[model samples]
Target: MHDAVIGGGRSPLQPRALVARSWSRVLEAGLDPDGRHPRDPLPMDQVLARRRESPVALVIEELRAIISSVADASQFLMVVTDADGIILWREGAARVRGRADSLGFEEGAEWTEEVVGTNAIGTALAEASPVQLFSAEHFEAEQHPWYCTAAPIHDPRTGELLGIVDVSGPAMTLHPAIVALVETAVRLAESQLWRHHELRLERLRAVAAPVLASVTGPLLLVDDHGWVAHTAGIAAQARIAVPRDRRPLTVPGLGLCLPEPLGDGWLVRPAGGETRIVMTLDLTGPPAVAVSGERPWRAPLTARHAEILLLLHRAGRSGLSAAALSSRLYGDAEHVVAVRAEVSRLRRTLGGVVESQPYRISPAVEMAVLGAPAG
Candidate 1:
């Protein structure tokens, strides 16, 4: 069925829609269906660096405890990769591990659809969802002997993709429950990640409690993402614009403030009662908003938010309505809801610096655009 559908581009027994889509993407990316591609896994030192940097590393023991024992007993390999689909860890029976190595399924190997054709790891990453592929369902002929099930793990705080966890083994031994097992493990991992986040916040609250008691005015102790860990005098807000070291943030109740790092988090104090903020919007390079002064730090902006800010700044006091903003951004007003949603996120990043009667910069903010508004 795989050859008939992918080779001849037609088959009476159609591949699953997801599989077919992955095959199309692999072909479009110029990956060969029949030819073998040899890859050199990244050097052990570099692989170690990535492992140290990946959040997945913290939960690896948990994953190994849950899946590695099963893989070893079942003649399978438990694999983990960063969101880029680069394999970071692989463990199982030595014999099964050897077989995987023959297929270049080793630590540090890039296994995305473009790199190695459609399979569980690559397809899961490409689709940003779970995937299971067996035998001939794989795009690369070399992978026809194996079955793989994989699911993505995401950061509980940001929903940013952390990595993928996969189980792969001989095709004939593929159990119907393998995919479910992988999905369950991913859920457990994400929950554990959230638990870790809460624990960190708890530590921050404990450390800052004494310091906060001494401070008199309305202020907040927030993490790097602007999550309020502890509030001194102000009503607590769930979040403000993300805090960058030394960057001035126009916090809603706190006014413009500079966030200074303290231990694991930052201490956000009103900037000596200075209510006005000066920001530079630089589109000359990768679009970043920079705040300069005693404590100066820069935060990179997403393209969407950058464009929205530019449009808002250009509009001046009038601001752009959701419908008008939608039309300007998407070439149609059909995206009004999307435009509004994005503006909400943008506001979270800039706090009171962004206002939404229509969506314009706050009058208290002095923003200067750098380079062409081409972003």
Candidate 2:
């Protein structure tokens, strides 16, 4: 079917829409169907570095137990990759692992579609959705003998993609239940990660309790990632931009402020002498955002987040709900999860300037737009 539809351009047994979409993308990338299966994997040192840095690293042993336990070890191999599709951890059937080694499916191999054509790991990353490919469904002829199921693992709190968990083996070993197994593993991993995050926050809260009671005036206690652990004297937002030394942070209602290092988090308070600040969202060129205060700063915005700001600005004081933002941004409201995630990341990046629970620009920020695209 892959050859008939992808090469001959037509087939009575039409490919599944997802598979067809992947074939089209692989073709566009100009990969040869007969290309060699093996490519040079990253050095061991680099692989270790990525493993240490990935959030998925926290749940490696749990994933091993969940996925490998459900399968006949010799019939399946489990692999984990970071958000960029670089394999970080791989284990399971030693026999199947040998097959994977021959195909360069070992750790540190970058399995993104652009590099290896349409396979489970790369396709899941491209579609931002779980994927399964069997036999001839693979874009690469060399991969035609393999079957794989993959699902994206996400950070539960912010909806950020953390990595992918995939199971693969010879086509003869493909199990219909493998996809479900991967999905379950993904859920477990994310929940474990979230639990870890919550525990850290709780510990920080404990450490912060006494310090906050003694402080006067408004302040916020946030972790390194700006997650609010505690607040006092101020009407607090859940998060703010990541705190860094020597850089000024602008908080809604709190005015411009400097973040001081607390035990394991930050203590944020007004940098004194405050006045109303005018912030600008410039849609001109590459999405530029600037804060106009005594200690002014600018943050770079991705085009998507830029559109988000433009929409919020247009929505005025009424603000737009996640469903509304989903419809406006994606032409449908089914993407509420994705919409919320984008908005969460935006709120964290821009801090208090963008308020939530019906997203809108903070009243404290007098926002003006320049060269915004007209609908």
Best by TM-score: 1
For model 2, how does the per-residue alpha-carbon lDDT over 222-310 read when each residue is reduced to its tens digit? Answer: 99998888877778677777786544567765777778888888989887765445788887778988876656778889999999999
Query: What are the per-model numbers of colliding residue pairs?
Result: 0, 0
Which sections of candidate 1 miss by over 4 Å? 280-309, 318-359, 369-375
Models 1 onward score TM values of 0.84, 0.76
lDDT, candidates in the order shown = 0.85, 0.85
Top candidate on lDDT is 1
- Shift in Å, residue 25, candidate 2: 0.8
